[model samples]
Target chain A: MLPFARVTVIGLGLIGSSILRATRSAMPTVRLTGYDVDPEVRGIADRIGLADDIADSAGAAVIDADLVILCVPVGAMGAVAAALADDLPADAIVSDVGGSKESVIAALRSALPEATIVPGHPVAGTEFSGPEAGFATLFRGRWCILTPDDATPEAATVRVRDFWEKLGANVETMTARHHDLVLAVTSHVPHLIAYSIVGTASDLEDVTQSEVIKYSAGGFRDFTRIAASDPTMWRDVFLNNREAVLEILQRLTEDVTMLQRAIRWGDGDALLDLFTRTRAIRRSIVEQGQDDAAPDFGRAHE
Target chain B: MLPFARVTVIGLGLIGSSILRATRSAMPTVRLTGYDVDPEVRGIADRIGLADDIADSAGAAVIDADLVILCVPVGAMGAVAAALADDLPADAIVSDVGGSKESVIAALRSALPEATIVPGHPVAGTEFSGPEAGFATLFRGRWCILTPDDATPEAATVRVRDFWEKLGANVETMTARHHDLVLAVTSHVPHLIAYSIVGTASDLEDVTQSEVIKYSAGGFRDFTRIAASDPTMWRDVFLNNREAVLEILQRLTEDVTMLQRAIRWGDGDALLDLFTRTRAIRRSIVEQGQDDAAPDFGRAHE
Candidate 1:
């Protein structure tokens, strides 16, 4: 149904390895190859049979592959692209799984001069990373956002869309800038807010600090999960997607300040109104199935 | 190990019913009586045998209660206290399970002029509500802050402390004002922020809104659970504990704003530093066994 006969996924981190596993399972006839700059990750993938074969280098992995996916951190896209630029098959479709699209496109395009690159982001992930953290169902019911700048060909874009669609992702296209902006509001800013709040609580004196942890199930524990995401990858995300995250953060800050004043001034109406208004949004999310009616956390046993 | 002959629990909500269930199992010899304004809640408690006996009215329940715990919302504390005020035995010690201690203390003090009143708060709960939402283990290994103002006699305070200790809650004491302020920072502000963000995400246009829910696992869903809390109860919390909530909320807003600016300016160092600093708090929480180290969420089957 699709043109990709030999697909090579580089960087067997959560996203890369997941794509490799899913593609392998769904497109059984197509040959799948994998590579990770980290030898240990490649070894693990080989041992688990996540790929048909594991390659030693990026160039070797993509040499004859018809589809090449850059699944490494957003910051590493450029170097990986450059390393494989010379050996990629002429019509190979190059795509990625980066959170921030603008920087990813800029970096990858500069290195791979002739590939049919369809810049995309699967708005799906877990807090865990590396090959073992991935499973085939990771992409089920998630969104795969395609950011096809002017350089991407229509045919290649369609093919990329089809690939993700078959993978069970609801695919949509938007400009790179808008993707970053919306995500800044929906994901990045929220994450930064979580990190900041957790940091603030951590700064409390030792005795109070221990109590905060002891009673975290009250609310603070939720923030800690987001704050505990892979530090290096998150650090790179903030660095690359700074502008959009900052903009949303600014608006959130102002809103929070207004709330702070209301609390300080003992304004019950303001507090109740906001709390009530926010509860409605949660109801909407539940109606949409984004959240389970059961407890939203501690799903490890599943 | 505790001295109470009969313990009456008023308003069998999540916390109240939990206290009764825990007490029933811990002090099998002590008579546990329960009363709730909600007929269904009372029915559930009766069916579950959470108490030795059930009463239709607060006064009827408190008549012989050596220990009476008012577990209604902070706003309703006054009315509940007043209703049972004249009936409380002279030697009866009254307490409460309100999130905001100051308001609960002020209400009960004015109502029961002849009874010994000592205010307390158990800093633990689940997102679920009603009698069905409680368990004996809810208070196990949790902290219970006992705010016995200067008027409470040492002997009375010690008895109250012993009761909580026997129920498996680690007990500590703080002034009513201090307890309210500390909880406002560690719990209330975080909840408000979660609700606000979830609300904002809900307000997004239809297309973007669907994506918000679909990809909610990124970070937004955590806020949804916190926001999904009992609306009326939360509304009361913000209303009754307005002062301290507002104060801590003010500090949080400032912190969120600073982070926003860092993102806007593409300040990687700022983002990285904040992210790294926040990781320590999570580590502390994990070390304290307040949270788990696994992918703390997404384990739906459990």
Candidate 2:
């Protein structure tokens, strides 16, 4: 059964485009309409036949929709929500796929005070961006966390949950603040570290940029994949999840300091102890099907 | 033509076994022999017929070999070299695949002062270890850096370069100290950061370990692959390459601090700029064929 019959996706980027494609594949009878502020992206969506209709504006997009899912950056969520507030149907349920839930939920609530809002975060994406890079299976086997405050109606949250499950996501419910903290640890800080290290490698005096790129297969290349993720999306994530991100970064920095001391003292046992313990986490990630078990990310060597 | 008629490999771990497998495929007619300190590993090599002959001892392995490659950890190179010295042929050239070149070169020189020493570090590996985890194509299209000192004969360096080239690697020569610093930026320091962060995440009091593992697909999992690398090998690398790794790590920490400040102050422009700059490097890595261009390292999404 289709949980959402007439859905409006109000951002035609990677996540939004993926939702359109996934909906088309999963529930063909449901009417899908896509809208984007960028004319170029809208053109691409239209050219690609992304949905049943391409709306000229956000308000027009949701005029007749029963569900509206905003796929914009966390920092822009409020503005987008406010822009579409006037024309949104009175009974339509609003949702989002922002990375940070607390800020997103707050922004969404302030913009659409009377609407039934369910903020969600699909913990899945690639380093690539834009409409062309997304695929229908992007959310398959991935987790989607939804944050709905006490004021949100239970029926609206369930419908949103059912909608995601139709698109192959495993849905879980949590408070916005807790969701933000969890995502800050799992996503934001790791991206910040990746972006920071890549910058460090490129700006080195002793190591030529050419040399760094050449021998990157040694280890630096792994960071590059995550570092290459969409800049605006990541920037908003850090800004919106500021407190939790900073807390985790501080913890990581202290841990790194301890390791620096271990290296300086030539304490092989200390270094070995940490290194050995980390292997168990990696094994669990693979065993749980969160990652590929094949060596080197299953990259082709030949 | 084969670079060496008889090649001896000591240490039947991932790199050593991979060397045996790659050599067998690249130079089918060359005589091959392997040895390891662990009798169990030697037995595994013999049962698998990893080489033409699996020597029972280090001395016996290199007695008639024209080329003896020490495929052991950096800290063990000196003692292994001392063990094989008495039986090594007078003209045999000694080389090593240790990650740190300068310390390894110094260790080999003190143990076998008159031997021709060519230190090498391959810019390729997987998280998996042990002989059974290796494959013949592990070195294909990878970089193998050789650090041979002025005192070493050019012919010895050339022969080692030729050997790696025949095994489908691109060979580059540089001074041992320079190689150490370059690798500190490219490999060693990157590894230290990965190990440190994984330790940090696993030790967090508020975030459950199970939650971290489940949400790892959000980027935490990327760090785990490198963190899971062989602990003994990495411990020796950080210990022996102490100066270079420490220098690069300090630089990375400073860069990370800058990112932390940007986040603290909500400097979206600065964060976005660094994130954008990093994407260019990832592009360069892909353009140079250093990494797979496919999104998410070409992982299977479904």
Candidate 3:
């Protein structure tokens, strides 16, 4: 069954356009309206026929939307939500695709006090950004986490869950705070570390940039893939999820320090134990169908 | 012309068996001898025709070989080299595929003072190990670094270079010390950080194991691929290249600390600048043909 007859997507970038494409493929009968703060993106969305109606403004997009999804950066969620406040239907259920949930939920509640708000984060994306970078299958078999609090209506939560499920995601629910913490560990900290390592490699005096790029396939290339993600989005994620990200970063730094000491002292046993233990987790991820079991992450060698 | 008429590989793991397969494909006339410490590996090598002959022992494998390549973990290089010392031909050119070149070169030189030693590391491998995990094209378009000192013969170094080139690798030469430092930055430290992060994620009490596995596609899955590399090999790499790895690790830790402070202080501009700068390096890597430019590292999503 269709979750909503009229759906509006604000910020028609990767996540927003992806939702439009997936909805078009999955629920062809539902009416779709889309808008982006950038006129260039709006023109591209129109050229691509991304929605049934490409609205001129956020307020125009959500005029009678039964469901309104904000797909802007976490830091921009509040401003974007406020843009549509006066025009949103009283019965509209608002949600967002932000990496951090707590800040987004608070900002959205502040902007649309009388409307139902349920923040969501789909645990799927490529390193690419913008409307053209998205595809329909990006969220297939991936998890979409819904951070809905007790104040949220049960029917609204169920509708959101049903919507994500219809789009080929396995939906799970948790508190906004818990969602922030889990994503901080699983996503934010890893990206921060990847960015740091790539920056370090580029700044090395002895190792030329060309040399680093040449021999990157050795191991550094994997980090570069994650580091190549959208900068503005990541900056907002770290800023909005500061406390949780910092806490996890602290734990990661301590773990790295322990390994550093082991290498300095030639503690082979400690190194081997940790290395062996980590391998099991990779196996579990593959077994759960969360990752490809093929060697080298299923990369084709030529 | 083929580098050598008779070539012996003293270990039948991923690197060793790849050499055997690549040699077979590139130089069909070359007589290949293979041996492994594990009887099961030798049996598998024989069953799979990994070499012209699967020798019963390392000593027997190099008895008449003109070129002998030791493909073993960095920690086992010394013992493996010593095992074939007495039986090695007087004019044999000795080389090894150890990640840490300095120690492997020193160990090979000490174990066979009269023989020519040109230690090399083919900067190519999958996370998988064992004879069954090898392919002829594993080294295709990858860098193969040879660390040959002034005391080493130029002819021997050229011969090793030619062998790798024939196997579809781009070969380069440098000092053993410089090779260790460069690889520590490019490969060793990356692996250590990857292992540490995976370990950290698994040990977190607030996030359950199932949660980590389910949501790993966010960013953690990239680290898991590198962490899933052979434990014994990585353990040996860290121990053998202690000085270089430690130096690089220190730099990485400092970089991480800087980012950590940015996150803690909500310095979104600082975070955005670093993230933006890192994306250029990824672009350079892809432009150099060192990595795929496809979205999500060319991961197949079904």
Candidate 4:
């Protein structure tokens, strides 16, 4: 393990708190400082001992730290970076766990010009948010994708990649643009569609509304879990990653319309072909160990 | 429990096998007969002791039975009903488990003119299909909706309702049109969207296509589970429930576009409000015991 020396993490949401917990577990000797605007979350982090020190301000957290990780929503990256820009020691390896890469890199680069910023995204989280929801094993066996276009120093990228490796995440590097496009299809557009479907179900006539909830098992339950994600965070992800999301949405709309036509025309072969092809990807995800077999039926056990 | 003198089930898919298993456990005295176009499926059902008898054809199954249940694809309801119409014993309570109610009712009513048709749907199933995928408790504590019209005989409807209740299901009655419309939003559209999203992800350029599956937990995994459902069955559902699904899809598309615009404008409030409302519905579904928490993620472990 290449010693992180002193590491600072900003924000204590699901991703932020998870990073703090994982870092503490993996590197007990490394000094860790955490800062979150939410005082209750900060206290939870302290009580749980996720960080060795709790910093009152961003500057207090970044000063003399060898590495700084922006674990906030993509929308807040710029402001957080600007706050700690002057306090960040020169050559501090800066990285992030933001969902969207392009906007984060652009925002952080404008603020922390002196720091070597290596944009990263840990493709892991639960519906729950804040410090209490975090666990040390959140990133275990998951992927932590890093996107560092031309300007990022190779040494800084390597350090951030190594840090992710210690947290039990497989590390891979890609271009910021590619990351944005891929995530738009994988995460952003899917989230938007989920939010939309759930919203539609919620608006049904009162009697049907209850039945919608009652019979959600048919398929609607899955969308609700995706829709349950922190609204502000998802909103920021979509806003920061607008063009890519819209592009993917356009493609999705075309595909949906085509499926609709197949249904209208009673083309079972077309429908079966499309549906069958999608199942292979699910098998791949299962083989890759991204999902488990026990489906949470959205109920508390009796 | 009211005795089922003789119960006939057509099509030995997941829902059919499940109802058969449930019936066997609930009413051991009831003589159960099953028929499917695929003789292999019937052989499996017989081998697994899922039914007391296996019929060679739909006509052979319904003859002399007190209750005949059409459990084929939604699109196949008419053909199955027509085939058995002449052979169905007089005064027999004919019901179906088609995902779409309106079409099922209309087709059965037109075909089985002399029979008491009480259309129904058990709002429960798994991604896996076939007789081997079923369990005796598949319908236990789940909603079994009956959509019989005003003209249907009360005794027939009550008998159908009682059958589901004996199998440990909570039975409710509503208009077939209403059931179709509500399910359009809650089930049909969601399945279509999930299938479309998975299809889009699969079509992505090779490198990204693989990563999308690898990192599916970030929300795409849920879509995959829904998309991975039996293609033939879903294709039939869409074709048979075309009008209601299309109507809901149009509304969903408009709602999705609005959310897309909100994301573009960085309207966190709009996104947050919708997200919060959708979360409440999911909670309500859990409270009603219709869904499980993190259901998609748990499928991996199962």
| CA lDDT scores, all candidates in order | 0.79, 0.92, 0.91, 0.82
Task: Give the DockQ of candidate 2.
Answer: 0.88
Q: Please give the interface root mean square deviation for model 4, in Å.
A: 2.9
Q: Best to worst by lDDT, what's the order?
A: 2, 3, 4, 1
DockQ of candidate 4? Answer: 0.56
Q: What would the per-residue lDDT of candidate 1 be over residues A211-269, giving only the tens digit for each residue? A: 67776767888888788777767877887888777666656656666766665666667
Better of 2 and 3 by lDDT: 2
DockQ of each: 0.49, 0.88, 0.86, 0.56
User: Which stretches in model 1 have alpha-carbon errors above 4 Å?
Assistant: A1-3, A28-30, A43-49, A205-207, A296-302, B39-52, B204-208, B296-298
- Give one digit per residue, the lDDT tens place, for model 1 in B65-125: 8999989888898999999887888889998888888887878888876778889988887
Q: Which stretches of candidate 2 lie over 4 Å from their true place?
A: none
Off by over 4 Å in 4: A205-207, A293-302, B205-207, B265-268, B294-302
All candidates: TM-score: 0.90, 0.99, 0.99, 0.94
CAPRI classification of candidate 2: high
User: Residue-wise lDDT of candidate 4 within A111-153, one digit each (tens)?
Assistant: 8776788899988887777887777888888888999888987
Clashing pairs in 1: A246-B264, A263-B246, A264-B246, A299-B299, A300-B299
lDDT of 3 by residue, A200-224 (tens): 9889998888888888888999999
lDDT of 4 by residue, B98-131 (tens): 9998878888888877778889999888777788
- Give the TM-score (vs. native) of candidate 3: 0.99
TM-scores for chain A over all candidates: 0.95, 0.99, 0.99, 0.95
